[model samples]
Target: MTKAWAEEILDWNYEPPYDFYNDNNKEESMKELLEAPYFAVLNDSGNLAGFYCIGYAAQVPLGYLFGAYQEDCVDIGLGMKPELTGKGNGGSFIRFVLEQVKGSKSIRLTVADFNERAITLYERAGFKKTYMFAGEEMSFFVMEKRSL
Candidate 1:
C-alpha cells in the first residue's frame, strides 16, 4: 500500500461499535501496511476504498493455539473505508477481493465474533465458520471458502 493511502486509513475513525477497528498506532500500522502482503483497494473514482492482506500477515496470534490456520488456504485480512461500511458496498467489495484471489483453491479469514456485519458479509461471500477462539478481551471466528 502507498504511504498516502495508509495515512488516509489511519485517519479513518469508525463510530461506536466499530471503533475497535480504527488504527491507534500510526507508526506500527504504517509499517505493516507498507509491507509486501498488503494491498490497497481503490474505488471507481480511484479513491481508496479499503485494503487487504494475505498469508501470515492476516493471521491472529491467538488463533494458532486453536489450530485455526492449520489448513492449506490463503488467509485474508481486510478493512473497508469506515464511511462505506453498512452502506450496501460490502457485497461488491468482497466480490472484488474474491476475484482478485480467484486462483486460490481455498480462502480463509478471521473476524471478531461481535462484528455481525462482517460475519454476515463473509457468509454471503460463501465463507463458512470453521473455528472460534477467544482472545484476551474478545472472541474471533475463522471462516473459510473453498472452490475445490
Candidate 2:
C-alpha cells in the first residue's frame, strides 16, 4: 500500500450513532499494515478505494472474544475512506474484496452490533452470524461466509 493509503486507513473513523473505527497511533497502525494481510482496495483509476485485512486475528480491541484466532475460518477487517461512507458503495467494495479471496474455505468478520449498516452489507453478502458478544464499549457480532 502507498503511504497515503496507509495514512487514510490509520485515520479512519465514523460519525455518531455508529462510531466504529478506532484511532491508533501512527507507529502501531503502520506496523500492522506492513506485517498483516491487509490489502488496499482500489478504484478503476488505481487510487485507494478502501482497505481490508484477511487473517485469523482481528484489529479490534478484545477481538479474541469474537474467535478471531481460529485458523479454520479466516477473519476480515475492513474500512472505506471516511468521506466515502454512507454512499452505497460498501457492498460492492466488500464483494470486490471477497472475489480476491474466493479461494478460502470460510471467511469471517466481526462488526460492532451497532454498526447496522455494516451488518446489513455483510448479511446481503451471505455472511451468517456465528455469535455475539460485548467488548470494550460496544456489542459485536461474529459473522461468517463459506465457499463451496
Among the numbered candidates, top TM-score falls to 1
lDDT of 2 at 126: 96
In the range 4-116, model 1's lDDT, one tens digit per residue, is 99899999999978898887888988998888589899999999999988889899989998888898999889999998999999999999988888764699999999999
C-alpha lDDT score of every prediction, in listed order: 0.91, 0.78
Please estimate how well model 2 matches the true structure, expressed as its whole-model Cα lDDT: 0.78
| TM accuracy, model 2 | 0.86
lDDT of 2 by residue, 21-74 (tens): 766477987887867778888899987878888774354557666654454776
Off by over 4 Å in 2: 57-61, 65-71
Error of 2 at 4 (Å): 2.9
lDDT of 1 at 5: 93
